[model samples]
Target: MKPSEEKPAIIALPKARRHTYYFLNYADEFKSVYLDTEIDMSEVKRRRDKLKLSGHRISYIVFLIEAISRVIRLYPEANSSVKHGMIPQMAVYHRIAAKFTLDKTMDGRRFVMSGIIPDSDQMPLEGMQKMIEYYRDTEADEITEFANVRKLQSMPLWLGRWIYRLAMGNLSRRAKLQGTFTITSLGHRPIQAFYPIISNTLCFGVGAIEDKPVVMAGQIAIRPMMKLSLAFDHRAIDGALAADILTEVKKVLEFASESDEASTQGEEVTPVGAST
Candidate 1:
């Protein structure tokens, strides 16, 4: 052999030592839940109609932002992650990484948009909607813009992966500070639901609306239903807390229609001496 290719350094460890090393090196775990909720689509539709009159189509994005805000407010525990090799910490960052498609052609390009959520408890729903509309309406321009970003295009796959890991490591706590959640709306497609695949993050998938019987007031009634799948890092949150978070989110969506109806009715009412 050309200069005996120095046999790879063979350093072996005892079984127990190896087991300990592997366990300590493990990153995190993912847990998911499929939640079916009764949501009223009528209000969302009406809002879309109103927005259409204004030449803006962004009702879905507004709804998502509102829903996420409610979830974060009600279940703060879900907005957190475990600190590696240390006791888990409670985080409070009102930032989330939103994934968006760049082009409709070529199987579509994907990118993550961070800092979508504001620092306050209230989110800029209208602003976010406008941003999404701008992105959606100018697909060609966005694609061209991304192409012009030489660094993004020229990075090698392995280098990209390394960069991603490093960035995630540095931003883990900052991103998971307050409203750390992922929402993916694939309901427009045929896919039913997706399992947790992202690392150190809670992922939620919104699926198509279906007709289902759900208890309203005190009796069971048929209503339009949507499925919500939530994936959490099991190492950080317990099963009970995760379930509680999902339960609260369902409650918010289920009553969203009622709230919208009440608001509409209030707006339509004429004051004491209103003109006809």
Candidate 2:
């Protein structure tokens, strides 16, 4: 057969993924600064194992969210987003809201969506995990947010673009709709490091955890390590502040112990949307 005659088949883009194009197009408005660091997950693994043995299992993403949320609370500048105009303005949030994406299957096709955990700094580890589990396990059609995403996908491309921009134009609503920052992970695969785009001021990229050689006490030893990458809009955040936040998150993750878990469990705070 002639090479020209043996062409590969092509498929149309699914409506479910239509929003990603809008998101990427919108992300182009910001100039993002990227950084990556390796985190030693040895202690965190040990703590998680202990918790799991006690029937209080916590997911790695939830744990990282809790830690990073606290760090975000410490750095006010880190919890802000920029609104561009004739002169740009920064919208600082009083609460730390963590946004994480989920891969959902709808109508036999897979699509990605996100969920927000408001006041994440105040939420306990178990509570955050519960919300994440809900997002992961629930049917996409059943959840109001995911349902809205479907509606957007079903709209014409121009209409969807207008609606998305309208919703994202207001910083306050954008924070509530999205979050102060975003966390995306490819940890299920063997990928070690990658950079992500930013909608808000910051976006965190998480890579898989694997055994790697590291120096400890002046000796090389194998340790369970994960790659954490941060992408920040330089217009809203400077490199110094971003580095500080990344370092703080790394410290919170690497030095985490059973005591840290105990402290969070002892905090008297309601879950994200619990009635008062």
Candidate 3:
């Protein structure tokens, strides 16, 4: 065939798998909830400074994940997913999982794929930070869920498009590959609260953190503030439940600076491995 007339590449998925896109396309509406909260990061800042001196490193994402775990533990619905069915039943997960994507360099080009931390409600900030760093550096392997995604990306553009949508769009498959809840961020760049897309049942968008004045102990004081935005599947979660979940998440984050002995709000959570 002539170079210009070359056929588009095609990699076929099993009939059973190809139907995944059908279910994913059923989601009709997504509701976004915007939350603005000011946090006291004095303790976190102090710890970060010390950790840098010791050659250990961490970021707000660690604290964000830590807080996320606590909220998922209490709000079982937030950890749940809507089943891909005629009725679209809601499935509440006994274990909580949070998903995110990290940038990776492959062939000198940037690649991003889904990642998950299962049973996240049990992991601490330190553990979450370490996990994030590990995923960022690791290649496609048993430890890396992006291996299949990377493979799919290698196909011809035309073929990759059909397969990618069918594979990633399938809610069931995505939850299995990624997680029930998703988190994405533009890093620490934007100041105003940004509304993130509601692709999954629940999602968190991390915004910039800058020094902003806030009321503390009846006096205005400057504190490092960050913006967090949430998107929820209206079919799976109602506004009241979503609000409660967001409130609890904020509480966990604000109190993240406390010691383990001081995290008396709820018992700590653990990471649950991959699940279908």
Instruction: For candidate 3, write residues 1-276 as lDDT tens digits.
Output: 799999988955433232233323433444455554445556656766776687767786766766776767767767766655466565666766778766655555454555787767676556667778778777744445555655655565556556755665555566676577888777556655656665567888777777889988899988887777777877777877777766666665555543542222455533232132
| Higher-scoring candidate on TM-score, 1 or 2 | 2
- The numbered model that scores best in TM-score is 2
| Model 1 misplaced regions, further than 4 Å | 1-57, 83-91, 94-115, 119-121, 140-153, 172-179, 212-222, 257-276
Model 3: per-residue Cα lDDT at residue 68:
73
Order the candidates by lDDT, highest first — what do you get?
Answer: 2, 3, 1
Predicted candidate 1 versus true structure: per-residue lDDT over 1-276, tens digit per residue? 565876767754422232223222333323433343335554565656776787765556456556555555555565665554355454544444443222232225343322233432343445666655665676533544334222333455445445444544544533632236656566777655544343444656677766668776999976656666776677667766666666655554444543442122121222222364
Ranking, TM-score, top scorer first: 2, 3, 1
Computed on alpha carbons, the lDDT of every model, listed in order, comes to 0.49, 0.84, 0.63
Q: What would the TM-scores of all predictions be? A: 0.62, 0.90, 0.73
Top lDDT: which candidate number?
Answer: 2
